[model samples]
Target: MNLTLASGAPRPSQTFRTVFPVLALCWLAVFFDGMDVNIYGAVMPHMLDDSGLGLTPASAGTIGSWTTFGMLIGALTAGNLTDWLGRRLMLVASVTLFSVGSAVCAVAGGVALFGFGRFVSGLGLGGLMPLCLAMVMEFAPPRRAALTTGLLMTSYHFGGMAATGLGLTLAQAAGWRWVFWAGVLPAVIAVPLLLKLLPESPGVLLARGEREKADAV
Candidate 1:
């Protein structure tokens, strides 16, 4: 069955009507991805101040590097996996992995645990960026692809702003743990919505030879 346009027209021009919702969803997910990615930096000062973490300046820097390293691995592996797994599943998995990492940070007893949590989260975090970009790019109309790419990138800044806002407001009142807990909120909110609403990438379906399914979009 063919998808109807929002105006109830039978899929007309393969223009904004087909693309806007997909872009919006990817934009929001990328926004949260940005927020989650930056939350560590935003809370670093508080983490250092806690004293309980026993994080020296040198070690702190090393931990940051480790998290980045984790992200690098995650990105590479997830990119390859996306071809086999499909975009929607990878996005959901990425969100879930990071959310669990946030929770792990919330209850972490030491720097090691916190760093490990960040690393685990990084794996999911790294995968999300390219996946979202690719999905949006593939689905966006030819003339609009570049514009959509820019739009998706903008969500990173928006997510960073949100993380900064949370750090300023919640970290002061409730403690850094609360900030991490807040990070988990995206998993709760975004994961279900993504699984339920985000459409499968048509390219992915077409590659799997599910032409009927792809055209149904």
Candidate 2:
């Protein structure tokens, strides 16, 4: 069956063909977002056990707070940036930032460095959800928007599960640093696909008054 937009203009079949690919890309990005978000908790015990890092309860709490603070800053800024950067590019940058942050943590020699790494990761994490939801809304069928959203959210839990499995299997044998190293994998896997395949949201282009570009999208 053909799906029609409320606008009753373009044929929905053509639209949905584009929509599904975009949805898949967004879902994968969000999946990594979830994985990175929960990976810290999954590996926290091991982090505390590592003597070189010096993770006391007070300092751990402080490190976690720095992550949250960075998130607050990122979240506040990302929406504004979206107008200029476009959602797809912004998502790419967010992923790259967090992946680099995780790499920093993986190699960090001191508390201050690790804390800064987590803060950087948090900033990237904060921007991801809002950008993803907005893009998903733009791509999903009107009647199925809420249902599609619910479906998209399940990827996050699946991501958390993958992080847990990685922690269980790899943390003790390879070390906590390996887990953070694993965090870097998302950039390797996701960024290339995003840049090569995922089309920018037409809504964003139209909003910027680039009607020709919007139609091309």
Candidate 1 per-residue C-alpha lDDT over 106-167 given as tens digits, one digit per residue, 9 for 90 to 100:
99989889889889888888888988888888777766788989988999999999999988
Write one digit per residue (lDDT tens) for candidate 2, span 55-109: 9888988988898898899899999999999998999999998999999999999
Model 1: how large is the Cα RMSD against the reference? 3.4
Give Cα-based local distance difference scores for all models. 0.85, 0.88
Candidate 1 error regions (>4 Å): 1-14
User: Which lDDT value does model 1 have at 17?
Assistant: 67
Backbone N/Cα/C clashes per model? 0, 0
lDDT of 2: 0.88
Worst 10 residues of 1 by lDDT: 1-10
Would you list the clashing residue pairs of candidate 1? none
